[model samples]
Structure formats: structure tokens, C-alpha cells
Target: MISKKIGLVESIASKSNGLDDIRVKINGEIQRAYNYPKLTGEVNIGDEVVLNTTAVELSLGTGGYHFVISNLNNMESNFTPGGHIMKLRYTPLQVKVDAVEEQESPYHDAIEEFESLENMPVVVGTLHSMLTPFVASYKRNNPSKKLVYIMTDGASLPIYLSKNVDTLKNKKLIDSTITIGNAFGGDYECINIYTALITAKEILKADVVFVSMGPGIAGTGTKYGFTGIEQGPILDAVKKLKGMPVAIPRVSFADQRDRHMGISHHSLTVLNDIVNVEVNIPITTYEDEKLDVVKRQIETKELDKKHHIVYINNKNTEEDLNYFGLSVRSMGRNYQQDKEFFDAASSAAYYLMEVCDDSRRENY
Candidate 1:
């Protein structure tokens, strides 16, 4: 169920290509809200808007912001029928997008005639937060290589919700964006990860592609019940498509939960069980016992027989992030707070760069 209320748009906090962060006065209380211009026309100051207060009412982690359902002062809909391919299908907010693989799309023939990814390096991260550091590390050495981001619909459906994506773009860390599955607002859109990878290779001409979710990953506290499980299929898809699959394990010592202590069980499950393809699993080097614990988890699962474990020392993640003028935090923990976590992502990035260089030498 949804809880909604009419609110007055007090001010436009910020505005971007397809999103607007605004302040609204609801029931004599000022609150933050988001406005999607394509769905409901832009909201300006003094405009009365219908706000969806569902997440806020339930005290969910939407950063305490409501979503603008409609702008009363601007009743005109700004939506354009981009294509017949629909995202959020059958929902009240269903939106049409020009998926690259769709028949009507200009690149439909290119997608249909696609042969393979030609050993292109694809880094698969479990969390949305991994995008920044991974991009930073990869681009740090390969500045000339084009790195495309393939955002899966494992978390937020709209790509506009990720300020991290915007930051990476602003700094030119990422060369292109492709939203796959139900996620929208990327530079390119595809119906699934397979087509998205093909599009990245053929259409975008990307040297490396990063696959991850947007933001707000869901977890139900049960094994195989988290959104991060998508990493398994994403990695498998890359290998099946003849691309190099490199997985960044979710590692953390700061997380208070038992499951996320050394190497996250989510990553373990994906690396050990879900993914059938033998992929490169990069791990970070540590001075403390963190390394041992991570190795134990892998050995305990007999992951060595199924995958290639690459030990990479990447302590320059913070420096890399700082060099790009970007800061990222996962689960409310900054790089320092969760050094192993970011390092793990950076380690994969380091390894991916090595693989990507080799791929270019052979394929290009």
C-alpha cells in the first residue's frame, strides 16, 4: 500500500537531467522529496504536488525523502514514447524505453548479428557502492580505455537515483552507461545483461564494462535471499558471452553482522554455488588476519576447484578515489571504516586492468 499527501514545493534543492531533489511542506512540516520530470512535469516553488509518502511513513531508507507523484501546478505530462519496450511493466508508472535489442531500435540488427564479447574484461560487483572505487582503480591505469557501466535491475529501477554514477561521469571515470533489465535513464538501455554486454562491446565500443546494481540493495536475512545474488548470473552471462568475468568479492570487517564479517556470504554463495562458470575471483592482500579468514571461507567451500583466486594488493583505493575527487561509503561505512571492503573491490579492479590489457592485445 502507498501513503500519499498533497504538499507544497518549498524549493528546488537540486536539478539534474531527469531528476529533481526538492523540499516540500507537508502538514506544516518541511521534508525532502524527489521529482521525476518525465513521469510528472517539473515542480517549481509554490507548486502543490502529490507526494508518495509510503517509504517515509514506514521509516525506510529512502534518505527520509518522499516521491512526487504529481505536480498540481504543472499538470502537463513530460513523457515521450521512446519505444514499445516497457519497464515497470503493468505498473501505474510503467515507462517506455528504447531497448537496444528491440526490433524498432536502430541497433537491433547489430544486436542480432552479435558474435561475442571477444574476451572483453567485465567486472561484476555485488553492491552498488563498488562502482566508484572499481572505476577509479581501473581508470587510474587505463585512462584511454573506455569503461562502460552496465547497471542491473537488482536494486533501484531508475538509474537517476545514483549520485555516484553522476559523480563518476562528471570526473570521466566511466565512459558510458547502459541500463539493463528494468533500470532506466542510462545513456543506453537493454532488455537484459546479455544484450547490454553486446551493446557495450559493439555499440558503445567499451574496453571494459562494470556490472552492478544501482542503490538500495534488499536483504531478507536468509541465505540466497539478497539482491546481490544477481552477481552470480551476471558473471555467468559474461563467460557465456565469451567475455572475461572478474568478480569483486564483498569483504568487510566493520560490518557488525556475522554473515558479512570476513568475506560476505553473499559473495561466497555467488562465487561458490550460484555461478557455474569458472571466473576470476580477486581478493585483497591484508597484513592482519582478514586474509586468513577470507581464504578459509573459500577453502571451506572448496572454491579453489571451481574458480581462480587472484591475490591482488590494492591499497591505493582511497588515493584513487581522492584523485578522482569522489568519495564512496557502503552500508554507512567510509573507506577507512571498511578498508577491506573497498580494497577487495580495488583488488578486482587491479586484476581486471591486467586482464583487459591482455584482451586488448589479443582482440584489438
Candidate 2:
């Protein structure tokens, strides 16, 4: 496709009779070389144009000295005599960055905790795209909880866990061998629904599992990630497991965005129709504390329980949220929202492990 950038060299907006006419300069030498007549009254001075000759049409609204041309990559944009110069950039509909640092992470709280744990709990999250860091941490800590990870790409877990065995043992987190598995799939397919069922099973087995992966830059939206999957199978899966499904959204640096709603928060609403487990949804807003209120309501059962949905108000203020790097986007609202959603997912996973630990001990 011929990528094009249109720019307005010059323009003058004027009214003749009842009609409006705009005149401007065109910079594309190709236009003159191709014997194309100059665009008359179509633009004004210092206007910009952007279009791809083979891709999409250039649409400039209102007054501007606009001109269209192909091959923006090879040339620099400049102003014309009658119109303003224009620059063009390419953007994809969806792009995901794993951002796995080759160097060690500067933050070491999780690592330190894992190193100190005698029985490490399994941490679960949606997607296997960019969890190299966590996996590495587990290996380094070598927790006894098997350092198990449930991922969408289930086929690959066995291999990944095996490779990390040495590190896992060295961290002294594992008194025994660690194992990982892919129950459903290995990727982030049907995260909310799949995890609800998986958590149920894990609970029945007396295993603690943590869940993360909310709406975020992780490219796992509700529609394509977890909540969008079929409800019937999800229900069946949870029924087979016979355990409660908790929704805990983490407010973390790895996740924090404004473009999308929290996946865990949304899961509460969506999963209510799918399963019967007790949910731990967190409600976050830009203003007042939302999750704390929800948590109190849940404790009092003041919130409607006619459905299985429950919202846990996080006792975090906006400032606290930002302190954890859970701030919304100053510019890219969508990206920031997505980040928040995913962070919630990770936090939910961590919380689940804690809750499960307590539940298992009580039952034991």
C-alpha cells in the first residue's frame, strides 16, 4: 500500500455568493509530474493532510490547504507556499508489548517474599505472553508450592516449569519439586470464565491459586480475553470443581490504565450469569473510594445478592492508587485504563491465594 501524508501548503477561506471556496498549496511534486491539476479552493496555507494512496482516503475537515500524496516513509514533510507542511505516522489497531526486562527488575518485594516462603502458593494470571519475569522469580525463589502457573497456553507450561526447577530449588521456596500445568489452554482464552472454573477446581483440590489479567495493555480485553467466552461451558467447569470463584482485581504498576474498564470488576457483572461462586470484585473510580464501600456492603450483605455478583470496594484513595503506579493516563486514557484493568487481575490473583490459604486451613 502506498502510504500518503497530505499537507496544506497555503489556504484562504472566503465566501463567494453563498458558496465557500478554499485555496492552498500542494507540496507533492508527484502531483505536478503526473500532470494533475492543482487543487483549487480545496485548502489553505499551513494546513496538514494525511492519507494513504492505497490504504485509506484522506479526510480533512473544514479549512486547510490540504493535498494528498503517496510514499510518506521515504520523504520528509515540509510546508508549501500556500499550505502548511504535514507529517504522518502509522498506528496499529492493536499492539501488545510484553516489556520483559532482560535485566533484573528493580522491584524485589515479590521476589523477597517468595524467597522467604516455605510453601509458596501458585500465582495464576491470564495470558502467557509476557510473564517471563514472574516465572523467573519463581524459579529464583524455588518455592515449595510447586511454582505452578496456569496459563492459556497450557501445552507449554510443563516445559517452562521443568526448565525453572533448578532455580526454584535454589530459592529454598520449594522443599519439593515444582510443577506447572495448562488446564484449559495455554493462552488467555476466556480468562474470566476459564479462571472461575479453574479456581473452583483448585479449591476443591485444596490448592491455593492467584489470578491476574484484567483489561489492560496486555491486549486481553473482556471481549477477546475471558468474559467473552461461552457461559455454558464455564458453568459446567465450575460445577465440576465445586469451589467458590473470587474476583480480586489488583491495583499494580504492571497494570493501570484508563482506556478500558477493570476486567475483574466487569467479570463480577458478567460471571454472575455464568457461575454460582462467591466473587471478589473491586470497584475503582477516579473520584472517591469505591472498592471499600463495596467491600463494606458485601460484608453487611447490603449489596444485592439476588445474583452472584459482588463488588469489593478497595480502600485505596486516588493518591494511594497513584503511589502504587496505578494512576490513570494523563494522555492515553485508553492505554492507561487497560493497564489498570490488568493490574487488577494480578492483584486479584494474589488475593485469591491468601483467601484460599485461609479457607483451606479452616477446612483442614
Candidate 3:
């Protein structure tokens, strides 16, 4: 399943945290590649490296970059300290992380002491692209709210693979990050979504939490094949833990694919077949014709019977993104090309903040 080749590092692109983006010459051509210093050690110019070239060979969604499997010149990698929990378990690259729920963790007692989320607002979206608009709008509207991001292993296994995440963190748009399942490289690690949610509230003291996978979502044309289907169970987990769950519908009028036009069939399947609990779904305010299309889908699928569908006015989404200087895209389409897709996220973010505030007032 893996394709490998020997490459010579030609130039250094950039280094941030544990990730190094470099250009390597393979097969007489210079190409982009990524090296995780923690996994393969720091790469240097002129160093020989083993690259996993499968993604590029198959034209997969790896952003046209190969992955450095190992640095031949710097063969030794230092092991990180603490924790018995192993993520990427049983793999050659398996890493031991100090998960927040482990017995040896400093927050272990707090994690065990967890009761309920106490109605902490948890916004759930199926795509990594949803993060930018959601975060920008929510932070713009509620600047003081602590937003913790939980990256699940539905896509990329390493959190460093997402430049969006690094940019958000650098901008302070995201307060903290928690990686769950096999995903790693975050401020904190958790064994699963359950502890990740606990860590977001109980430990990070976040006012709201956003859950999505890292970049590069997997998809197939079939009804049950996309990685975003994880959104269903994620919503269920939020409800089961007594957290308020708000779902960002996958709305797009720009997509040429019929299955993805009004509301993606993937989302339709999740809300219809997978999610077994009540979840709030937010859609952006649109013109009558566009609104009618979404309304017809909701009625046809009986989505309203199972979930709360709220229309939120997210008219300033593009302006909000521009104000924050955050560039976001999905399926290679920018905000202008795919307005509704982005609006869905911004609308959900606004509604989530409102619901959180209303809940707080009721309790007060």
C-alpha cells in the first residue's frame, strides 16, 4: 500500500513546531515533501531520505507533497517523555503519548472526576474546511470565549499536516488543541472523543469546542464511503456526554456533483441513518429559491423530525473572513466560488455562540 523512493533534500522550505516542509529531488526532479522531525528526525539540505511517494503517484489528496519516511543521514529519533498510551497503535510509526485520560497524566484525576459537559457548546462539522469560517466568525462574535479544537483521526493522522491549524493557533483564533484517536501533534492528546470532550471543558476550561478531523478528508462516490460520516457518532457522543451538539450542514450550491449540490448526500446519510440522537443543524439565510431547495431536502429526508434546524443570518461571513485574514477553501473552491458551503459554517458558529449564551443566562 506504500510506495517509497530515495530522495535528496534540495532545499528547506520552512519549519514550524514538529513539521518541516522541504523540497527534495527524486528521480531527477525537485518536488515538495514533508518531514516530521519527531518521526524521521530533522532533515537538512543534502540529506538522503526515504520518501513515501504513494499519495502523489496515485494523485490522492495529499496536497501534492510526498512524506519523508526516514532521514538516512540522521537515523536516530529521540523518544518523547511520559504516558503508556500508544497512538497509531501496532504500526511501525506507533507513538506513545501522554493522553489526558491516562493514569499517569496530571489531569487524570480531573478526567476521572468528570461528570457531564454541563451543556458546554460543542460544534461538530464533517469537513476540516469548516474550521476556518466557524472559528473566525465565532471568535469575532465572542472574542472572550475559550475555543478548544479536537482533531479526530477521520483523515490525516498528524495534526501538523494542517497548515490551517497552525495559522489559527498563531492568530490566537484557537485557544488550544486536543488530538484524539490516532491523530497526534497537539497541545494535548486523548484516547478518544469522550476524553477529548472532557479535556476541552474540564481541563482546558473552554467555553466552546470545535470537533473536526485534520486536513485531507477521505471520500468515495458510494453512499457509505466518506470519512465525514464520523460526524454522526461525534454528535451522538456530545449529546451522550450532556454537551449541546450543533451540526454544520454540508450545504453547497456550487458543486457540480448532483449528490453534493443542495445538501451533500453524505450529510443526508449521516443525519438520516447514522446519528441516533437529537442534534441542532444550522443553515445560513439564503434567497427564497435556495432556501426552498434546502427546505425540500429537510422535509423529504425528515431531518426536522430528528434534529433542530435553525436559520442563522451569517451575512458577513466573507467580510468576517477577510477581517480576520483567514483564507479558507473546500474541494479546491474559495469563498466566492463556494459561498453557501462557507456560510453553513459561519451560520453554525453564530448559532452556537447564541445557544451557549442563552444556556448560560438560563442557568444564571
Best by lDDT: 3
Candidate 2, poorest ten consecutive residues by summed lDDT = 32-41
Alpha-carbon runs more than 4 Å astray in model 3: 62-64, 361-364
lDDT of 3 by residue, 77-102 (tens): 77877888988889888888888887
Best by TM-score: 3
2 against 3, candidate with superior lDDT: 3
Pick out the ten consecutive residues of candidate 3 with the lowest summed lDDT. Answer: 355-364
Candidate 3: residue pairs that collide: none
TM-score of model 2 vs. true structure: 0.33
> How displaced is residue 36 in candidate 3, in Å?
0.7
Candidate 2: what lDDT? Answer: 0.32
Model 1: residues with Cα > 4 Å off, grouped in runs: 62-64, 358-364
**All models: lDDT?**
0.87, 0.32, 0.90
Alpha-carbon RMSD to native, per candidate: 1.7, 18.1, 1.4
Give model 3's TM-score versus the native structure.
0.97
Error in Å for residue 147 of model 1: 0.5
Off by over 4 Å in 2: 1-142, 153-206, 209-236, 248-259, 262-269, 280-339, 358-364
Error of 3 at 355 (Å): 2.4
Candidate 1 lDDT, 101-187, residue by residue in tens: 878789999999999888888899978999998888888878998999999999888898899988889888888999988899899
Error of 1 at 225 (Å): 1.0
